[model samples]
Target: MERENAPVGPGDVVALVDGSFFMHRTYHLAASGDPARNLRPSDGFPNGAIRKFCERLLGFLEAGFGGTRPSHLGIFFDHSRRSHRSELFPGYKANRPEPPADLEALKPLFRDAVRAFGYGCIEAENYEADDLIATYATAASARGAHVLMVGSDKDLLQLVGPTVFAFDFEYGVPGRSGYRPARLFDAAAVAAAWEGTPPERLGDVLALMGDQTDNVPGVPGIGMKTAAKLVAEYGDLETLLANADAIKQPGRRDALLAHAETARLSRRLVELERNAPMPVPLDDLLLGWPDPDVLFPFVNAMEFSWLGRKLGQLYQVEASSYPSDPRFAAPVAGSGAAGLQALRYDAVLPAEGAPPFASDTAHCAVSAMPLSMAHIDGWLRFDFRSPDLRAEPGQGHEGWKIHVSVDPGRVAAAWDAILPIVAEARLQAKVAGPALAGRLGDSSHRQAGKMLVLYAETAPDVGRWRAVLTRVEEALDKAGVTPGPRVAGDR
Candidate 1:
């Protein structure tokens, strides 16, 4: 496939997607309904992941970054599941079970779908999608083109710098009608997410606090906050380990001394390989107008009427012209925000005793303060004019959270009492932290009282949290729950 237009030059946005990450996530969490029901009409092939992947990519391309469409795009998949990380540490990602057989069978179709859109479908042997994304991002950055790394993987955050950013596309939770809003993270967002440990030093934090998902042996007992704190204090992992003997905390000192080599290995495992050999030069990835000749046929075969409408909008034509497979039933709604009936908004806030959020303009600019993530406290979640759209057991959603510690003493009363308050406040004021906790897990109730600590995402809008709190307080006056003293510096 050839691009019909000129390739992107300097200052164009190059969007690189982590294909394997998206495919598996879509197959498991984003694609609605059963895989059996979403098979391609031409053949009995499962095309749920393929359809959702294309839908999201199209949505992203339409949405663009800061009102600019991506000049180039690459969907890079893992050449194989195993990567150099596994070779460096045998136990790497051993904790993960095998990808579903049905999902694995659909990889080739995903690649074909990418090609149909006239975008680069790339993969290199023994390299993970992260490495490829890192490499392309680095190359794109060096060329003076901005890089947008798509996917929810934290490992990719290390690539966020002056001209590079990461975007986590929002998707509907499994078994839910509402969708999570997409989030864009820049250097400040990365620092906010990683407890003020700069994006470049996130590897040090990850090294100290091993990733259970990847089975990296970060020093045991070291969590994200502790690791971030240590890295912030010591500058890096090596410095922290070298000065372990002078550490005041006995347990931490002992863990660093005991797992010095293990921590080093974890760092290596978590670090991205930015120098992978690309099968095609960066110019080859530049996107042109989507060929209706190729795209229409694929969507037609799959009976993607909703996708057809989106494509029609993209091509500036009547959506009715596109044909769908008569046998397959079309989705009840169209694609993107307008098609979805409900929106689930969730965000992190700055908790009490934390410094104000700071925005970073070098990467991307947003108004917000950095809330402290010093500890995990019990969370308070409520609905916003929608049915409970929680995920099924063991399913994963975006990890973005709005941290507020509900009073344990008032847990019973506050649980049901805050529903209407949250819903109304969110609707009237348009605060961005109104969503159900998709899956509940273990949380601490240590400061379970009138105190409400709002922990924001790395860099979050301070006014959003403040507005929500003001509305919640006004509503609370008429309800059972009592508002605690507001945090200092809170408007």
Candidate 2:
């Protein structure tokens, strides 16, 4: 059944995992050293170390898969001591210590354990796991299979392309309420965040700085920042070396001139071998189900009770033993502020009034029209009117009478209490109706007399009214309009 679904397709993905490096790192962190050292224990076994290590790997894989499973999975391990890179740089990764005795003892066990889980494992003599992964990734890409390389190593950034992504599995923090898959750092993302240099040139950049962790000797004295800057300017190590004299700083120039050979070699060391042999075909890389019964025993033997329980829970959930709801209530009230407020309105002015421009109006026609209104149901509304007393355009168009209505019945004393609030919240007199008054003296006013209409809404919550008033004031300020004095109640 698993074989039927194993073939590579358009959406099929292959996971090129660095099993050897990951296991060594995890084991080192979990178990410091063998309790009994080199001498075998009385039980005639090499301690139960490999079992524990396998348990951790199993747990990580299970969690990595989660509810959705990957189409293909392949674990690449480092099998050889002399990789092709060694020929280019004699001192490539030469300074690292050998794997610890206990971990070394369990290396074979780890390989067997990966196989037990029905995953295709690959290792080439003298080639690092990275080379094997690069080889598989290149092959998978050529075969039209998407590849997700799962590792945090910065060197893997080179493999990221349209079809290939790098996943940093170690950075997964527990209890975070999101499914943050290992993000593939592409060329653009790397350039933007990592000193603005392209991912392909990252190797050349690293070669100049030298990775101390990987034992690659970069140019002495130059650090990451300088290397990035030099690469950004000169493009790569070859050009930078050729134009050594062009470097402005004497210190950097001297460093580059002095360690040109080392920088070149370091570049070779950091470069991934894309043509290495892949043992498994891209189609065979599809993930297959491991015997859960066998897997649980392995977890139990390793004393990983937590992992065992988690596996059981995973299986149960997959079997639909757990009930889940699609319409679960969200944290928001109704999507967000949906049920918070309802709109309402009231009238403070008479339905029929003077045409607002009585033909024979006098100069003192500025009426302080006091209109009082309320939102009985905790709703508030504001109506403002600015009348031109002077028959002229620009001269007397600045003054305005604002009529604000408050729901006196809804909130006791709301009328008296809201008056000061509204007064404080009124628009600036000069700015209130500036646009309309600007045309006051212009001949356009005879055709369309300037009038200021201010509208406001009130709620039981003073904060809501205050917010609305602030918004209105801001709008008036932006629009370059000034308001007139406010009046209450309808006249």
Tell me the whole-model lDDT of each prediction, alpha carbons only.
0.63, 0.55
Question: Model 1 over residues 165-273: C-alpha lDDT tens digits?
Answer: 9997666665688666677989999998788978899999998898888898899999999999899899998988899999999999999999999999999999999
Clash count in backbone of candidate 1: 13
Mark the 10 consecutive residues where model 2 has the least summed lDDT.
326-335
**lDDT (10s digit) by residue, model 2, range 193-256:** 5688777788888898888777899999888888899889888789999999888899999999
Q: Score candidate 1 by TM-score against the native.
A: 0.61
RMSD of 1: 22.7
lDDT of 2 at 70: 61
Task: Report the error of model 2 at residue 279, Å.
Answer: 1.4
